[model samples]
Target: MGTWLRRVLLGGLLITQGAVQAAEVTFDDIQPILQARCVMCHAGEAAPLGLRLTRLDELLKGSKGRPVVNAGDPAGSELVRRLKGISQPRMPMTGPPFLSDAEIALFEDWIAGGLKAGRNPPDTPVAPAPLQRPAAGQPVTYAHVAPIFASRCVKCHSAYGLMGSAPEGLLLNSYAAILDRHERVRVVPGAAGASELVRRIRGQSQPQMPYDGPPFLSDEEIQLIVDWIDQGARDTNGQPAPSPVGARVRLQGVLGEGWTLDSLPLVVGPGTRIDKAPEVGDYVEVRGRWGQDGRVLVERIRRR
Candidate 1:
């Protein structure tokens, strides 16, 4: 994440909710309206007037030459006229009126308010300081690993229980609970090649963690855990360190160098749909276990 990109993202997050609640013209509010109404015809190859309502940016920006709205000018905007049943061949060409009066009112109010940019708020604020990893020779203390777990893993694992089955008597809710497991599979420092914890994440084991969706941990995140374990898996109490291992599992992804990619994993994730063309040379990461013959059954996929 570059500083400028992070700043832009932060700025977007800071003002997104207030704008949505106050003005009502947010991506969250507008997206469903477009998808339910406009996307029927104004998407894919049959896009009308070169318009695509699949994304907020495209909707706000409008067609190739025509602007969707004059910001706050409903009267001057052609979109308003068409939706008001005044223009020829009205939108959502079939079925019931896709939007209620309240929904239309939102668009009107938003346009009248100068089409403000939307934001996605941060649930838990992350400080600007980069998270520090353990030193090469140091141990993976509970204090050090706990923060990382809390930041990433705990969101899903804490409540919905992605790591293991709750009824099966497995839990990672706390460091002590995790450490006291029957197999103690959490971490084994100084043995990077024998850790089941690492194996599950790297896709060696069945049914990956963060099971809610695709794109589990990025390579960087996986590397951080590996580095911490390689140093030594220790508790904050500075007791004897536990060993860690690296599984045979590997994560494969497309990387955009100076070359082009012809193919990539199109369908990944358990029982997920794949129905789009990946842009040529676009990078994607896939997690899977390496077979003896070097084949892999991809478990998850995400952008690189």
Candidate 2:
């Protein structure tokens, strides 16, 4: 064989050998990068989606709500999508200076290599809890709503969010932040109709929420939020939020759904002071505010 041909053949052999000898990726390979960039938002009890990336076990466990990384399927992992900005809010929350294309590819390789950074893969990994929809008629609370916001809304509305700008000054990372009384009134304890949050999500108001549309929140997901707001937007403890200023609804229906006058459903609790007992067909006027369960807690009822 010619000298030049022999050299070319030798170079090709070396390249093929290098590909065959590539080392398997391990947890140690990705730890430093995650520790520096992701650990802040993904560790401890308050981690969004309870995705603590501090250890191999935790990373394997993935987000409590969904798989952040899918073993051998980089295309399926949310972590890869976020790092590449294929998903919104993106990762490291604060970036520009975001993970480079090379960094993202390294992550893809990690996932494609069965997701064990350094430790031996578990015999049977623990599957993280799925984001289950609440059962029918279950009273909605922060537990049900927080995940929705963390996954969908906070991307633009949080301080550490992508680009770090709350488009319309709405920040929903926490219950306090969501409830912080602002001029826009994102949530109104017992009034879903009056809430800007609901309006935007329902597409009733301009610039429909989550800001990222087309694949908007599912009907079930949107209802969870509506139910939470209509149910007095309570915390995890489920205590009654202070009622919204009651409207003078002089409803006169046959007590089917609502109104002492127009038939609006009113919650006549043990503490309600009834005046002049009214028959089933009688008209009445009710004065009350929002109750813990979202119904109008009647303070005073008079048969009209």
Candidate 3:
């Protein structure tokens, strides 16, 4: 039905079915698909950020009164970013179960081509960008923690966020801002247990964060922040910036390759607490922190 062939499917722009490539895509091609896949939480008035997917116009109207689409630029579009998860909180809200490559392509091509009702050949080129992942056992740093803030916190902690810009003059929108030595400092690096940020999210303090949900930062997400702080609140370069010690992490995995846990070397010290005498080939749990030398300095270990 389209003038183009579908071969390379990626992130919803179904230009790839086998190898996935773009087709003569149009809004009509995917309207029904969105109706089926996205109209759930995104259809009615109570939708988050006022974003609705019942029609092309509504989708184009965007969320928070900002445009989610970017005419022919899928990378610049927030909708595509969320679909591919380049942005925070991947969508459909009920997914993994997410849109198929073909389904996603229809939307991708529609956006990258014309993002309109009528069929049209692609006028703009679309290709997947390379993705980056951290190296194994990488110590948590501002780089890891920053995106989480941007995704979950900044909406309320910004000038555009609270009543008059960054409540109590505390901002979580950037690296330096979060580390601001202001009177209302939120992060106290290396010591998440003592940090105001951690206390609030863990609900040990008043008014849990995201200030918006029962759907708070996931355990994995909170752990990431905790790890960042515990590892001494390192910067993007894995270097600490004069902070306190973070709470210990609970790591469970099989012991392998001589004093290695999950392929990482463990530093046993006079201070390390051990129980049941763990050995190689035994399953165990370790509670520890990243040492300055880039290895786990075991605080406690036990056979599980």
Models 1 onward score TM values of 0.34, 0.43, 0.44
Provide C-alpha RMSD values for all models, in order.
21.3, 14.9, 15.3
Q: What TM value does model 2 have? A: 0.43
Which candidate tops TM-score? 3
Per-residue CA lDDT of model 2 for 21-70, tens digit only, reads: 47567666777677556664565675666787766778778887887889
lDDT of 1 by residue, 46-68 (tens): 35567766655666668877987
In candidate 1, position 89 carries an lDDT of 39
In candidate 1 the C-alpha lDDT for residue 188 amounts to 46
Q: Give candidate 2's error at residue 150 in angstroms.
A: 0.4
lDDT tens readout by residue for model 3, 1-304: 3434333324346424534334567776876666554654464555568887766667778998689989889888898888877876665443444567777776778888767665433322121111123579777767666656655676566655535566767677566677665453456665565456786777654467778767898887788888887777777777887742333344555677767765757788899898998888887877776455545668899998
Off by over 4 Å in 3: 1-59, 63-113, 116-135, 162-164, 244-304
Task: Name the runs in model 2 displaced over 4 angstroms.
Answer: 1-128, 133-138, 244-304
Report the number of the highest-lDDT candidate. Answer: 2
CA lDDT for candidate 2: 0.67
